[model samples]
Target: MDYSLNEVQNSIKNNFASFCTKEIAPRAPLLDAASHEQVQTMIKENIKKLADIGYLGLAHEEKYGGTNLDLLSQAIAGEEVAKACASTFLSAGASNGLFGMPLKMFGTQEQKEKYLPGIIKGDIIGAFGLTEPEAGSDAAAIKTTAVKKGNEWILNGSKTFITNAPIADVCLIMAYNDREAGPGAGVTGFLVEKGAPGFVVGKPFDKLGFRGSPTAEIFLEDCRVPESAVLGQVGAGFIQAMQTLEYGRIGMATVCLGIAVACMEAANAYSKERKTFGKPINRYQEISFKIADMMIMTDVSRLLIYRAALAKEAKDPESAVLASCAKLFASESATKISSMALQVHGGYGYIKEFPVERLYRDAKLGEIGEGASEIQRILIAKSILSKIH
Candidate 1:
């Protein structure tokens, strides 16, 4: 019933915004301009910095060296971090939120004891390997296969566009254990270490945006792991992935919201500072309306994101539907808002000197990554149609 953030959530929002402004924002341009190798190192440093402030462990259990904040609080922190640097936010989430959260949610006691603390401490980097060359949105179409032999599991496949792949110390690899049974009952997830025999991480890709967040391919040819490497119950990988992605969608939305906010700020500031015909551009209706639309989208996206976050935290039955809704709106809004912001800057936005150029490029991945806007529409439409008589 509440529409506003409570005291603790507000405090988290303010504190994270302040810390990110002071520590993270300054490195954003540096990260954007760094070489692939250099950016990877800088992102590692950003991860450690986030860990030092407990941002890496937001909403996780206190026993695991986490801050134990609520999901809404975590979303708040995510927005601030993403507003500072989208690449850092994406990389950090790939580690703790995507990789570590699965372990926390489904890992055995020993798994938690071994990985959670180190992951939260930022001592170990993690990656989630699910999307393959063929299975970008259709996760069930992954060609990876795992077969049990004696006391070990042998895995073989490749994952592309994996976040943090170039630097991950550990990865959760999903594959089919019984292809005939389909993803719901056939798939399994295994914890594979970086140097495991036959497991090779390819060179980082030269990306158009999010250059600081290293993305690469993972090749596993007859990769072997002990029986203890299973992530959760046998035949539960598809459900686990679905569950993880539902939560991840909320994160994706928050980050997009952050990008929208950044766009609005840039546009508003530039409109007031830049002048045309001896008057500030803000006085022009064309410039003023674009800024107005940016403000409206940013505000609306925040509400949608928080609504989804609250639904998720409450374990609402319709949470998945809401998550998709938020993600679709926020992500598409980001692309629109960023373009407007860039247009507001005129020639300066096209140049690398202005952050809007980077924001424009970074805003695009949101619509495609996590889940595509097309897929979101399908899900939302299906959910609605399923309810009608």
Candidate 2:
């Protein structure tokens, strides 16, 4: 129960922060403004830098060519990357959590042997395909179906709002294997390689935030893969997706915390110089109160994020509950704090020239992605009731 970060974690946090400030922060705005091709290039180059430094796989085992760091290190790494640029963080986040971990956990030795080496080397990009046009929070409601045809399964359906779809070399797609068993019980997971017949990448979608990361629709029409492509077993996709989301929530919370910290830092620096009524605006009770609340929330979020990370490292039963709580509180708080920071900046905040505006926009996705805030609350309540009963 040691709350203090060890020397290694402290050094890692410091190193990662320095790297983000020097390497990633300067290009963030430009990347934010670039076209899809330009942004993709920038992200690919940055991913190489991250991989070279061993930051790309903080949570995976060393034998898999990862750093094998614990959850705390992973959280710290995520926060640093997020602080630089939320989109870049998300790009790596998908590779690390949704793609890399699942492969390590459920992929057969052959699957891992085929994928992990390139993934660890940053030679290929990975994506997760679960959400469909009709399925957001209701993951089990996915309509994508994989029907057995001889030795192969034919997949048909479409997914929207998928990040990394445009450039991904591989994807982990979930679909219904037994329509008769209903949503959760009938589902299965599969790894579909790029350029598979009948599998096509759809056009990119314009999004409100995370503009630096490309998102697209994914269409599968009679996309066929060998039975060996199935991940885990039939009827296990729902459970696996839920598990992936548990880890993904922790990563999302860390990203939100980074935004919260950035908002607080911006507000603090502005308050000291902003004058109102011939006095510093920070001297005013109204302005000071907002700053105080932002600071308090940021601190609370950091602790919650750390606690969730610790619970995950310890393999505690409550890790899932903690992860959901952290994601819910930190994301909602980021939205509030970022908005307030913009208010502190006055009219400039509304302008695209200011980073706060983008941060504000980015903060919103934290509430909607991974799992929505409502879903997090439902999960927390479910966990609580289980303990009570």
Candidate 3:
């Protein structure tokens, strides 16, 4: 029930905000408009800056050159970065905690030693390859297969809609080792290096939002990796992916909360300056109501995100349910609030000059990625029914 952030968390939030304002905010638009190489250069520069501030691995263990902070701290920092540019935030999030955490948590000591240091240092990027062309919400039905061949595993399948895949140096890929055993018993995870033969990354995708962060399809054709690359035990990949996403949902919700705040601030500022009927737009009940709703939704979303983070940090069994609830409400609310902010801006909102337009685009990805709002609702219902039964 305690919602107070500790000193370290507060400092982290402040430092990240300062860094974003100074280093990221100014060039965000340029990066969004730049060519692929230019965008990559900008990302590298910012990532180095982020690493210098120890923001790259905020949630990892201190023993591995990380801050070892709790979930709330991670969420708070994510919010700051996301507020600057959702794509940049996605880049950092995927590298630090989303795809890398499971490896750090379940990988062998050799695997950790090989990947964790580079990831923590921000020298390399990582991605999770779970959602395939055919399997997104039905993760268990993934058709990617990895057949055991003596000391190596032959992986052959394609994963689409993989965030950070285009630039990732490593990937945590999920595949079926035994189709007959079903999702829980047949699935396994592998640590696939970028240069491994038969592992090909497709071209970057054009998207509605988060344009700075590229996503693509990853093709694994007879890809062979050592048995040591297997993460945890065979047939446990589904659970690992689910567990990782539970944590990822908290981060995604935090990003949505940030977008919501950005929408409200922009709307409030514009309403005051924009005049109608010989007075400021704020005088109008219609505009005022929209702003009020935006404020209310943003605040509520923040609380839900914080609650989920707290539950995760406390290791409560309900953490997954809370995370799902937060993700569902906060992401959907962000979409709604951003749309309203655009409406408040009138013609200006639709133009590229205003940040609200970009924010509106960014807010939509939250509703679709990191488990869609519909998927979150399904999770919530399952959780409730499980308890009831």
Candidate 4:
């Protein structure tokens, strides 16, 4: 497989790199210290900036005001942005990946026109509510219910650890329409707008990193939406969520790859400058070896992430397996590389003085979110075993 990026892809990479340096990097630390409400405000403001630059819709349809870029381009955009700030990347990338992509794939024409423009135009923020207190990875076991009431569907449940939930203007929430039928046949996705009666958002939770990106619990106490709010078909939400997650895992791989690359960069630069025994630490075998390992891990993660994104671009049959492979490797590599990067920075890394500390904290989420490492392994094994059978 070719490793070199084409001119268009390179252009996307360069543009986002510039955006990160000029706009995101300078603000990352400040945002990290901001209050949750303030961060939510910045997320909305950042969305407008991204939309103005024609980024929010890069991989969407041109008729819907997107640039019509491919999945690889979108991944490149995310990779660059994440290098500067994980929170910014999560906020902006989720706008399209976790939110817009599903709607595009499943929503009706009216639904598309009604919501996509505002999202693509940065008029509203979007969220995906699937993980519950009881349904983190075992989504099939989620107890959230949606019962039909005349021409409306009433949703009743709670979702936790939901990023963007606190300030989301719109959300795609998953619930079961038939408790006896199981998720495969009873699950459904609903488009719930902000201020909907009975839809309540909890206070944002403080976290180790991605401080500017908020996560919260949401309660749907008989929250109601018209039948038209159903995304795709009733009893199809589980499958739709699985497919959406495959693509989201690809985006997440790039985000983790970005963090990994940042780890390598921070370690490499620090090693050269931090002197030991009146000489640069980079000269020492221990320091050099750490850098070497970090470099290798980062590069390998890049290969895996790009491979998955390119597979999606080419419509490869192995896209699902590759996405899981990429997410698993890249996320774990990020944690390892970030920890090493922090170690290289010594005591300084333990504080907010350096970006490595933030990266170190943010990297942990890579292993846990989208899908955990264990879940990815299960998916990969399932893929291989199903083929053999």
- Candidate 3: tens digits of C-alpha lDDT, residues 3-113: 677787788889889988898877777767777667667776766677778887777777778878777787888888888877788877888777778987788888888
After superposition, which runs of candidate 2 have C-alpha atoms over 4 Å from their true positions?
none
Residues 308-346 of candidate 2: C-alpha lDDT, one tens digit per residue: 988988999899999999999999999999999999989
Give the residue spans of candidate 1 off by over 4 A.
none
Query: Between candidates 1 and 4, which one is better according to lDDT?
Result: 1
- Local lDDT at 316 for model 1: 96
CA-lDDT, candidates in order: 0.91, 0.87, 0.86, 0.87
Best first by lDDT, ranked: 1, 4, 2, 3
**What is the per-residue lDDT of model 4 for residues 74-173, given as tens digits with 9 covering 90 to 100?**
8888888888888878887676668898999999999889888888888878899899998888888888899999999999999998888887888899
lDDT (0-100) at residue 374 of candidate 4?
99
Model 2 residue pairs with clashes: none
Model 3 residue 281 lDDT score? 94
**TM-score leader:** 1
Error of 2 at 263 (Å): 1.1
Per-prediction TM-score to the true structure, in the order listed: 0.99, 0.96, 0.96, 0.97
